[model samples]
Target: MSMADLVRAGAPELPEGYFYRVRSTNIRSLKVEIREQRRFRSRLVADTWVFERPDESAEESIVKACDRAFKGWQEADAVRASYLAVTAYLGDHDPKGGR
Candidate 1:
């Protein structure tokens, strides 16, 4: 299905600078990657199942992956606040596009 269709069909909403990719590992396996957009490229932020066996449906996995990614982003911000403050003190005000 198209991305829009997937989004309409209960997929989680992506925040700005965030997106996902769905891929089939084989006939019986699928994978979803949630990423954060950076200046030159995107970085893999989190996933739903990781190395675990695929049990959930593709749509379900997509939604779960999005949720995990979004939460990961928030947690990163919280965990990195001190680091960011130090960088800002050093004059690097813009980091990760303020994502």
Candidate 2:
């Protein structure tokens, strides 16, 4: 096989995914940021994001990030389902987006 053909044969399909970053604040709080994978030319990049919120606890932070990331990671059916469950559990609860 030619070099280009060999490269193509060896290349694996890339699945879209979410990328995250965590930063500690003071001693009791932290922030979480999430970005989804995107294709740039032939490469996948998850450097840009749709959700960036301040998180105080790691577990809670993950939930909040997933909440915001539902839209960015459109392929995540599980996240959408989880969001519905959360909403159902917290009926009448409203969330305010912070500035």
Candidate 3:
């Protein structure tokens, strides 16, 4: 699937003012930035995914960058979900996973 399609399917409800763009990509690096809550206090978070792209065209670079960004977002979401689950399991408990 395309990067856009993957992001849309995964993050159906994006924060207000959330936006993503390919920042730069070359034979050595791919970079993308995701901006969220840009109304008054905007936050810009960038993630870079690198891979060898020798002989790749600009269009190919862009597509790869977008894909990397999408993957990074997905990985971040998974980590967050796991953390929440652990937190919930811990709750107001002691060392044990209980209240």
Total backbone clashes of candidate 1, pairs 3 or more residues apart or in separate chains: 0
**Tens digits of lDDT, candidate 3, 1-99:** 443553554423344566655544555555566657655775765465544467885555555665566567778889999998888765355667545
Cα displacement (Å) at residue 40, model 3? 2.6
lDDT of each: 0.67, 0.43, 0.58
Off by over 4 Å in 2: 1-17, 26-28, 36-61, 69-99
Residue 6 of model 2: what lDDT?
22
Q: Determine the C-alpha RMSD for candidate 2 after optimal superposition of all C-alphas.
A: 16.5
Q: In lDDT terms, how accurate is model 3? A: 0.58
Best by lDDT: 1
Candidate with more favorable, higher lDDT: 1 or 3: 1
> What is candidate 2's TM-score against the reference?
0.25
**Candidate 2's residue-wise lDDT over 1-99, tens digit each?**
222332244322223454454446565555444444557523222222223356454344444444444344444666778888888766454577433
